[model samples]
Target: MNKNVAIIWGGYSSEIVVSEKSMNGIYSFLDKNRYNVYKVKIDKKGWTAEIEGKEYIVDKNDFSIFFGSAKIEIDFAYITIHGTPGEDGRLQGYFDMLNIPYSSCDWMASALTFNKFVCNNFLKNFGLNVAKSVYLSKDSKYDINAIAEALKFPIFIKPNTGGSSFATTKVKGIDKMQEAIDFAFSEASDVIIESFISGREVTCGCYKTSDHEVVFPITEVITKNEFFDYNAKYMGEVEEITPADLSEEKTLEIQQLTSKIYDLVGAKGIIRADFIISDNTPYLLEVNTTPGMTTTSFIPQQVKAAGLSMTDVLTEIIECEYQKIQKSL
Candidate 1:
């Protein structure tokens, strides 16, 4: 019997666009012969399922859809939502209460990784290399000069809990610091200002199952812009090189570090970790609990570089998570 899988997408964030693209990518990668897939959109509008050409309201109580004389129950949720309710653990908690298996980290892990400042600081205690950063809550007050003196000039200001690099800004002086912070705060309640590390930008993806631990090849990001901003990420302004041209030692170290972070964060499904290789040391940038799944996304590119199929990877994730749920039951 084929399980009905809901490829959940859309979130109350600017990253919804990326989430939609990821949802479509997952839909295409899923093995149709093994499972019945459906598109479930969860946005400000509400939870709804998209059928052939119509949208059906989803019953939030049971996470089901009622069509013409048929009640389609979702046996699993392949969450691709990039931010907010989905990536921040709200959706995960809801699915947990329903005892529905999902294809991402649990509520706690999702929440932990979603907050850049909190997660990085937490990981830093474990001796992980992370750039010096300052956290700013919406209501918190701090002197801009103090921040500049502490972290120095040329800093990166970004939303503390947002994804897709929306409203992220690179500031080189005090003149633009306030403006950058405001830009970032527009997307999130909190903001983070960190000392920028000049180095090659790279990201590595990893996932673990009862069977094996898979760490895809690292991809070096070369952005034509100042940094890998929104345009560089989705507007084809960046060059991505899979199996990043790094030394053997550096590559292994990065892969091992990524795998370690996954276990430390108690991540599930697929997660991607970004880093800045400065002075031959890889500094942790942030952990993506729910990475993008678009065909051109880093994960897919890395998977292909590792000589693996996306269909197989998706199946492995679903089966492993479903089996865990079955055991718990």
Candidate 2:
């Protein structure tokens, strides 16, 4: 019997477009002969599963969709939603309650990684290199120049729990710090402030199969549009060099660090680690639980470079999570 799969996309954030693209890439490679795949779009409007150009209501109780005359059950979810209720752990918790398997980290891991400040600091606690940062909430008091004096000039201000570099600003001077912080706050209630790490920007993708972990080749990101901001990541404003132009030593070091962090965070499925190599040390920026599966995304590029099959990768993720649920039962 073919298991029913739901590819969840269209989050309630600016990254909705990216998530939708991710679904498009992942949907085609899900091995249609092995499973019945349904596309689910979740936005501020509602959650609707599209079947044969028809919209159906998805039952929140059991994560099932009403297709025409019958109720369709979802055995697994391939979550690609990039922000808020999706990547921030709300959807994972819902799936956990329903005992439905999903391809990604658990609710706790998802929540922790989504918050950039907390995740970076947590990784730093394990002796990993991470940039110095200041965390702020909606009600917290802060001094603009004081922050500049502490972290020095040229800092990154971004939403604490956001992705795709949405509403992220590279404040090059102390004078623009307040404006950047306010802009980030517009997208999220909390914000993460970090001192700029002047070094090469690189990222690597990794995922666990049934028996062992697989880490893809690293990619170096060089952007002309300030930092690797929204335009640089998505709109072709940057150059991403695969194999990272690094020696074997640095590459292995980074890959090992990424795998180590995955275990420490109890991460599952596919995760990508972004880094800044300063003085030959890889400083962890943040871990992406629901990494973009789009063609232009880093993971897909890395996978292709490694000559790995996307179908196999997605299948392993689906099967591995399913087996975990089975083991628990």
Candidate 3:
């Protein structure tokens, strides 16, 4: 019997467009013979499932039935939402309560990684090299001048719980620091001001299964903007070099660190780690619990470098989740 898979996309996020793109990319690659596919979109109207290529709105409170129609059953959920409800653990928590198997990290990991302030501190406590940063809450009172004094010039101000580099600003001098912080605060309740690290930006992805953990080739991201901002990431404005021009020793070191992080976080399925290389030393930037699935995304690029097609990689993730479910039962 073929399993019913629901691919969830779109949500209350800044990366809504990017999520839609990922959904289309995934919808085109999934193996039809192995599963019954259904597309679900989450928007202001709530979650709606596509049946026979026609959308039927679902009740946000109870996801079992389509409005007043008959109940709909799904064996698994594939989340492609890029931010907010998708990456911040809200959707995962909902699925957990329903006892539905889904791809990507669990609730705890998702929640932790979604907030950069929390994740960076968590990793730092584990002896991981991370850039120093100061967190500001929505209701907290802080001295902006004091913060600037502490971090000095050339700091990165960003929303603490945002993705795709949304609401991120690179402040070079003191004059622009407040403006950058204000910009980030406009998008999120919390913000982070991190000490800027001048170095090469790179990323590594890993696939974890019951048998083993496989690390992919590292990719060096070159962006023309001040940094890899939202435009550079999804708009095809940046250049990504797979198997980044690095020595074998440096590559192996990064791969080792990537695998170690996956184990440290107890991450299942697929995860990507972003890093900044300064003076030939790699510093952990952030960990993506649900990495992008677009054809041009880093994960897909690394997948191709591993001699595996996007379909093959995605299928393996689904099958791995299925096997885990079977074992639990």
For model 2, how does the per-residue alpha-carbon lDDT over 215-289 read when each residue is reduced to its tens digit?
Answer: 999999999888898888888999999979999999999999999999988898999999999987888999999
Superposed model 3: Cα runs more than 4 Å off: 59-62, 65-70
Model 1 lowest lDDT segment of ten: 66-75
- Candidate 3 achieves a global lDDT of 0.85
Better of 2 and 3 by lDDT: 2
> How well is each residue in 166-253 modelled by candidate 3, as lDDT tens digits?
8899888878877887899888889999998989999999988876677999999998888999889878789999989999999999
Per-model root-mean-square deviation over C-alphas: 0.7, 1.0, 1.7
Model 1 scores a TM of 0.99
Model 3 backbone overlap count:
0
lDDT of 3 at 173: 83
* Regions of model 1 farther than 4 Å from truth: none
User: For residues 15-83, could you state the per-residue lDDT of candidate 1 as single tens digits?
Assistant: 999999999999999999999999999999898999997999899989999887899999999999999
- In terms of lDDT, model 2 sits at 0.91
